[model samples]
Target: MSTVACPDCEARVSLDTPVLNEIVECAECRSELEVLSTDPVVLGRAPEVEEDWGE
Candidate 1:
């Protein structure tokens, strides 16, 4: 398993076979996190989902 720091809480987050753009939640802060990179397991805050209105 690989470990990365949470962007929001700075807590250690473990991931098994992490993939790029994988979404995970922070156990300490309960914040959504996204996998920015997999080489060293970099993590960042997940982008908020926005609803698209019909144009």
Candidate 2:
């Protein structure tokens, strides 16, 4: 497991065998975060969900 900072709440989060581009939720702020890197444990805000009308 690795520790990463939350972009929204700046809280420490533990990632268990995280992968690149994996989506995770911040425990403190409950914000959706995306895994940008795994070496140093980088996290970013997840992209906004877009509505699909049977496209």
Candidate maximizing TM-score:
1
For candidate 2, write residues 1-55 as lDDT tens digits.
Answer: 9998899989998999989999999888899999998888899999999999889
Question: How well does candidate 2 match the true structure, expressed as C-alpha RMSD?
Answer: 1.1
Best by lDDT: 2
Off by over 4 Å in 2: 52-55
> What's the lDDT for residue 24 in model 1?
93
* lDDT per model vs. reference: 0.89, 0.92
Candidate 1 global CA lDDT score: 0.89
